[model samples]
Target: MSLQFIKRIFTSGVFLISANVMLSVTSAHAAVNIQQWQTSVGSEVYFVENHDLPILDISVNFPAGSARDTADKSGLASITRYLMTLGAAGMTDEVIANKFADIGAVLGGSFDTDRAALSLRTLSSERERLQALGLFANILQKPDFPESVLAREKARIISGLEESSTQPESISNKAFMSALYGKHPYSLDESGEIDTVAKIKKEDLQAFYQQFYSAKGAVIAIIGDLTREQAQQVAELVSVGLPTTPAPAPIASVPAKNQAKEQRIAHPASQSHILLGHTGIKRNDPDLFPLYVGNYILGGGGFVSRLTEEVREKRGLVYSVYSYFMPMAEAGPFQIGLQTKKDQAEAALALVHETLEKFLNNGVTEAELKAAKSNIIGGFPMRIDSNKKILDYLNVIGFYKLPLNYLDEYNKKVENVTAAQIKDAFNRRLKHDHFVTVIVGDPKAE
Candidate 1:
């Protein structure tokens, strides 16, 4: 199952009671009206007021993801973000955890290639909301980055990196990113390498935090039981004490690949893990709609995709094969990943290439186009079924500077994509001959 689905299942029980209460106030099809503004401290705010449930969800984002790290300090951004919640404003990690539990609140974070985010979920009642918002603001404005916690977290992360280094999937992923991105910041693993992470000190984290986690660069997304005035107050409180430095420079451009290259690493595993592709579009690329729809037909539609039909069912060369375009602030990888017996690796790879070539040459049929549109547009509501989900969309919209109507017009964009548009997008955005390939477990290894 997908990680998102798994997360939904895991967290469903925690919010079951609140979700039922919300049903009486609003239907699943309620419209989302987002309000956008900026705080006096220069933080941008996106608000969606929904009193359906007595719950509030807030996410604060900054341009402090791994892409902001220097080569020598590859994992600095992630570790800094983690340390913020562990201890802040004179509170120990245990104390912070206990306080949140007492208030029935949840604290979480997301770190990726482009941004770092801290999220909070809590009851919207006056007492509970005030307590939760106060603690959240402290974590954002006054992270202590204790030395003892830093050492422990460093050890834990190093242990994980060591273990993952020995796994074929990890091996292939790191190699694949390095091959595709080269010297770009995106190539650095979010979890810093052992050598680099070990050298990181408490001072480094404090400096990094001050530099990238400045108020001027903050994007605060708030959804749930709050009025426009209240949201403004909350934004001001969260951003009040943050550093007032200017926003950091934009990330460097992702370099283009000019030739196809393959790297094969020998391993003792019985199956070969393969990854191949080149840099694709950014989040705001004009071809986003057409490319998204076309990919559904090419390899993203599960068993119904052209890749699965050609490589898995017809020839039985592999159990599963999939491709996706991960659009980021900059061009992200357009990756196709698969696994098969070592003996069948070459055959699976060949069939994948053949299928991609045919799909590009012929484009998608009208029937395939209709089905893709139907599947994508039909499932749009589920994307914003709850306050928490809408909070996520607000974060994306504010951080990426996308049109406020992005979620509103999502289905229309998908419906308007034609076969010709899909064909042209695919042809212009992807060059099969320039793909970079990484394989773990040498197919010829015996």
Candidate 2:
């Protein structure tokens, strides 16, 4: 059938179902059966077959995040990804959107410090599935990087940067990352700077795509109404035509900070934005479970957390205060952030430090540990309760080379964490004296 006919049917809602019903059908069970393989062109494929719903989700990831860009072209990776689907293989962005809309398929992607991902959610029927896959494959392998689109996107990004420069929250975040990472690529904004983005050319995008979007480094995650054999076929179809270049080098190690440092940027805003952090653990760290559980009690558990109880509930220094460990390809930051009146920023920050140090020195109580585990394990099902969530896990697993049974053992890992383990892990992983702090709208700023 022609795409026009499909578009008419789709618009008429003939092929649509209630999203809640579909999600209920795909709710994860006690364990997920993940099958793994490699395409002929060397892309690693992870598959989970669930015939309950007539929907399919696929995520294709490459090690082409902003970290791949050089200092001179710091926004190269981001712009390359942004412009990829805008015009590929003689198709305009409008055509691409219309084609996906015709079959009720969604094409989306994500970029971060470690990976760039392209994803598709479509009906599992052969016609819709194959058509969507064809367009996706073409965009992956044959992006034209049209000069007009490149120029337009560059202008859009540069304008955003200019606007963000005046915003105190944005200013604080940029300064915090720069302070925490120093010379590392993680310090670079995912949205390239105005100057760097303006200098990015079509040739730069082509080179970046060719070097990093290669089959050798691709991770394809497929989950839905398909057999293992069919999943293999789908993987081969999407990956076979990608660039054959070898995998790029690993991201450089994050440097350590030996002393605590702080930066105060003056802004005209009424409240101060404070972010303080140090390097934390990687995705596959041995202490991950302990740290994860510990962090929940320390600050991640919403109003029930120690940070909130001490900083917000009791003293009213701020409305909210929180902390989290962002585990990445390397040790991502363990960040604590809060906002308060400009005059109260120092008091809020001092309390945050005291809370953290007390937690580190004394460790969590048995009650706190139990509550954290109970909360974590109770919510475990939601983590995989839908195909999209499972697809996300598949991407992380494949990209980080995590164990195949990671999900199967997720609750078990959380359950096994103990008060002692939390204490040891936090003490070893975070330092009380080596934090990098950035405060914007500081009252004391000259």
Q: What is the C-alpha RMSD of each candidate to the true structure, in Å?
A: 8.3, 6.7
Per-residue lDDT tens digits of candidate 1, residues 144-255?
A: 9999999999999999999999999999999999999999999999998999999999999999999999999999999988887677667777886899899989999888
Worst lDDT window (10 residues) for model 1? 19-28
Per-residue lDDT of candidate 2, residues 313-391 (tens digit): 9999986689999999888999999999888999999999999999999999999998889999999898998999999
List TM-score per model, in order: 0.93, 0.93
Candidate 1 vs. true structure, TM-score = 0.93
The Cα error of candidate 1 at residue 101, in Å, is 0.6
